[model samples]
Target: MEPPSGSPDLVLAFANTHADGGGRPERFADVDGLRAWLRENGLDEAADDASPADVDGVRHLRDAVVTVLLGHSHDPATDDATVAAAEDDVRRVAARHPLVTSVDRDGARLAPAQPGLPGALGLVLAAMTELALTGSWSRVKACRNPPCHFAFLDRSRNTSGAYCSTACSSQVAMRAYRRRKAGSHD
Candidate 1:
């Protein structure tokens, strides 16, 4: 099934696989879970070809991507060291498994330079590249609330989105309100 409307397919795939869902983490616990996610994302055709090591590799790459995206989304300016590190991590992975460019009857496309884990990561990286080129990379963000690192697209006109949903936003706001209320009474 497709993700909710307005979300890019690739971002949805990564976010759904890596993020917390309804206060519960949905990360893969084993190869079976990873395979299930692959099936869910219509990548099942390549699932059989992935080994246990490939699954581990894919998970690592996913985490790396999350780190990089979160780092960028949180702050686009003021080059923080952590953001640089996250970017370096992603660059290292991308360099390790580069994507190959090819032209077909339809148009140019990107393919993985290597099969298996690299191929899966290459597809994700290619999607990220597309977002970057289109200036939509900032739209992919991780919720600021601790332990709720759900990735979401900032569809707000001003791009000020900081949480996954109104519920999360309300939760944070309520906490702040209580803090101020308590401080005022002190």
Candidate 2:
């Protein structure tokens, strides 16, 4: 398949696309490639809507991704917790490149080629780890919505990315249409 874009935020945001379209999980290279990447990555896709108390920062990240990506909300109260966790995960991954950084303290040496992004980050540890370790990584991107939160990689050669998917574009268009119909551009 075509490789993903290069930006870290974009990678994180686009973490859970239905890359396989089989409607079943396991048809992917990683969390991004899994048909149910979001659920698999969060480690709770199969669990019944977990309680917010169980939804720690890590769980929140996955849930928020689901909310933004799938429009799913088993419980709306968990929204805040999910958002916080997602943000933290994004920050942590963004800060450390598994490719180039030494998680160990003593001898500075290149780590073994562990698989996946975390491994890649440990190996390279750079702003461009997503690109250098994975496919051309600089093309990662976030949606261009003011209140909307989504991420995607720009495959366009010109690199003019502004959204996670056409659905979002359509949503914006529909909102605009309603506003125009009502003659109220709020």
Candidate 3:
């Protein structure tokens, strides 16, 4: 799963690693599970070298990326502060592990400046940085519906995708309809 050729697929996959639908536990339950994720992302060598600390670092990075993307997906007019805060968080992490520039046939790409916990963490950050630089950050988002919080790419023409799937969107819409109907009764 080398990022699926999509600009934001890696970011979405990183965020989905800890998806908590309903009352279910995290998708990656432990360090081993995190290793599985690394392997799934074609980072088998990184997974082999991962530790508990590495798992935690990946989780932190994933959360930070999700927060930033969530900010992008939400209405910036009213959520400017939230977006700013999330950008600050991303900057803080980037400051800790700066990315380096690399050029190939595909042009320049950002790579981890230095080896940090779970070597793949830097690569993940690089992918996110690329998305931000390319103005595709909003394509990656967390579902607005609570509990699901699954990350997804907004492929809609107007970029109005707020849910990971139609099921979640329908559930939220139905709930709103019920509320409106009940209110009219009053």
lDDT of 3 at 14: 76
Mark the regions of model 1 whose C-alpha exceeds 4 Å error after superposition.
1-7, 19-21, 75-79, 104-107
lDDT of 3 by residue, 1-186 (tens): 132232776677778877575665564567788878877878887778777766666676677666666665673332667667767876777777666777679878777665524346667777876776777777888877766777888888898888888988888889889999999999
Model 3: CA > 4 A from native:
1-6, 22-25, 75-80, 116-118, 184-186
**What would the per-residue lDDT of candidate 1 be over residues 34-148, giving only the tens digit for each residue?**
7777666666655666666666667766766666656645733324676677778778888997877766686665666766545666677777776776788888887766556
**Candidate 3: global Cα-lDDT?**
0.70
What are the Cα lDDT values of the candidates?
Answer: 0.68, 0.42, 0.70
CA displacement after TM-score superposition, residue 160 of candidate 3 (Å): 2.0
lDDT of 2 at 94: 42
Residue 104, candidate 1: C-alpha displacement in angstroms: 4.5
Total residue pair clashes for candidate 1: 0
Model 2 — TM-score against the truth? 0.38
> Global lDDT for candidate 1?
0.68
In terms of lDDT, the poorest run of 10 residues in model 1 is 1-10
Q: Return the TM-score for each candidate structure.
A: 0.81, 0.38, 0.81
